[model samples]
Target chain A: MPTIVVDVMPKAELLDPQGKAVTGALSRLGVDAFSAVRIGKRFELTVEGEVDDDVLATARRIADEILSNAVIEDVVAVEVVE
Target chain B: MPTIVVDVMPKAELLDPQGKAVTGALSRLGVDAFSAVRIGKRFELTVEGEVDDDVLATARRIADEILSNAVIEDVVAVEVVE
Candidate 1:
């Protein structure tokens, strides 16, 4: 089955404290080169039926309506392997 | 150009508090069906050179070495829309 992954972020456009904390930890771990780190989310969904354009459309609609808060956050799709 | 997205999570197999917070908010937002929501990260990295197999290999190496905490977190590569 093809999994549908969703990455949702806060819409307020403010600095993500959680992300910063993680990034700080990473910097301590010796990855200090990157300037900033923004944390979001990852959702893997298993589509029961076929993987088609219609499914994608429905998924996009759902993302817009319920999965993501467009005003404060952004949603991106991560493709599944197999 | 293609973007390389990295999702890093906690490694120790414990409950993710940040994820739980987001899930609670999502449930309040009327998405009560999905039992849980685990928050990770979404990183958009622009590969400076080329989008080739070698680059992917290097990126995966970097993910393993610095980006993801293999002990507790899982790393998944999301394809970029180019």
Candidate 2:
């Protein structure tokens, strides 16, 4: 089976309060070297078919429609793992 | 070069309100097929060294110490992409 992982993050236009909160917490936790945090959704999907163009296309469409808030966020990437 | 991705999720014990909110929105958006949402942190790191056992180990330690909240969450996986 091929696993498809989607990472959805807030668009640059929107203020990511959640990410900002996490980033502040991380700073206190000693990850102070990195200054910002961008929180996103990661979906791990196990599809029961060969990983091909068609499957990838379907996954991309799904990501655009249901997995992401296109108005405020974007799908960063869709990765395939076997 | 190889990229290392880390997935950090809340421990089963902690309540994931963000995930719950997302799940609710997904259901409203017609993904009624699934019922829950689980949010996690995905880090994409481009490392300087070759992707080997030593690198992976170092990466794992980093995840445990800095990337993940060991007190409440866990590092589910560390994936290497070439």
Candidate 3:
């Protein structure tokens, strides 16, 4: 089974409050090497059947419409890990 | 600056309701190749300074403590993408 890994990140123009909060917390934790931290979502999908062209298209559609918000996020397939 | 990527996923023994929901939705959407779907978190961190042992150690600590729940989620540093 192919495990499609989809990465969904907040658009660059949008302010990521969660990321900012994480950075601040990290700074307080004495790990002061990060200038910025962007938090995003990753989905690992194990399709039961062979991943054909149709499956790929469906995955793309899922990423864009279901997994992420098109307006606030940019969904990209990072890879097929397995 | 080096960008460190941390991936956090729910433990295998734990039931992932979100993943299950996604799988159901996919099946309903006519993309019935999935046995399961695992949703996780990805963090992209641009450390301001060089990534030394201390930085790495801190990153590990951050992953273990802040980024994920050690009991429920398994956190791993998947890559150091530039």
Candidate 4:
């Protein structure tokens, strides 16, 4: 079955405490190649049948409506994978 | 500066309660196109300088060791992005 992938990330303007904590951890651990770290969510929706136009549109709708919180997060990508 | 994106996904054998809850929510909302849903993590690491081989290697190593748990999660991808 084909799968639709949705990528959601926190708004760039918002502060990501989780990412900051990880960045601090990395700094303490002597990994300084990275200056900043941001975390996001990746969702994989498995389709029951072929991924057609309707299914893709439905996925997009759900991604924007149900999967992600519009105020804090943005749906970055919606792609299909075999 | 470039960014290294690392994707981490939970093990397929394990039961994902959050994913199950979302699946149920979708079903109740009359969205039946998807059969299953899995949630994962995406990390964006901002590099201080250019993304070289060493930086890529470090990103992969940190992805496996710190970004994800070996027992429950797998590092699916570690790629550089602009």
For this target, which candidate reaches the highest DockQ against the unseen true structure? Answer: 4
lDDT of 2 by residue, B1-82 (tens): 4677778878868888877776677657665433444667776555555677876776687689867879988898888877
- Runs of candidate 1 with Cα error greater than 4 angstroms are A78-81, B1-4, B8-40, B44-72, B78-82
Candidate 2 per-residue C-alpha lDDT over A1-82 given as tens digits, one digit per residue, 9 for 90 to 100: 5677778877867788876775676657664333445556677555665767876776688789877779998998888867
Q: Which digits, one per residue and each the tens of the lDDT, describe model 4 over residues A1-82?
A: 8989999999999999999999999999999999999999999999997999999999999999999999999999999998
Candidate 2: segments with Cα more than 4 A from true spot: A1-5, A9-40, A44-62, A69-82
Models sorted by TM-score, best on top: 4, 3, 2, 1
Q: Residues A1-82, candidate 3: write the lDDT tens digits.
A: 6888889989989999999999999888877877899999989888766788777777787888889998999985546666
Instruction: Evaluate residue A79 in candidate 3 and report its C-alpha lDDT on the 0 to 100 scale.
Output: 62
For candidate 2, report its TM-score.
Answer: 0.61
Interface RMSD of each: 4.5, 5.0, 1.2, 0.6
Q: For each model in turn, which proportion of the native inter-chain contacts is also found?
A: 0.28, 0.14, 0.90, 0.91
Models sorted by DockQ, best on top? 4, 3, 1, 2
Worst 10 residues of 4 chain A by lDDT: A43-52
Judge the docking of candidate 4 as incorrect, acceptable, medium or high.
Answer: high
lDDT of 3 at B12: 83
Off by over 4 Å in 3: none
Question: Candidate 4, B44: how far from true, in Å?
Answer: 0.6
Runs with alpha carbons beyond 4 Å of true place in candidate 4: none
Question: CA lDDT of A27 in candidate 4?
Answer: 96
Top candidate when judged by TM-score against the true structure: 4
Question: Looking at the true structure's interface, with contacts defined as alpha carbon pairs within 8 Å between chains A and B, what fraction does model 2 recover?
Answer: 0.14
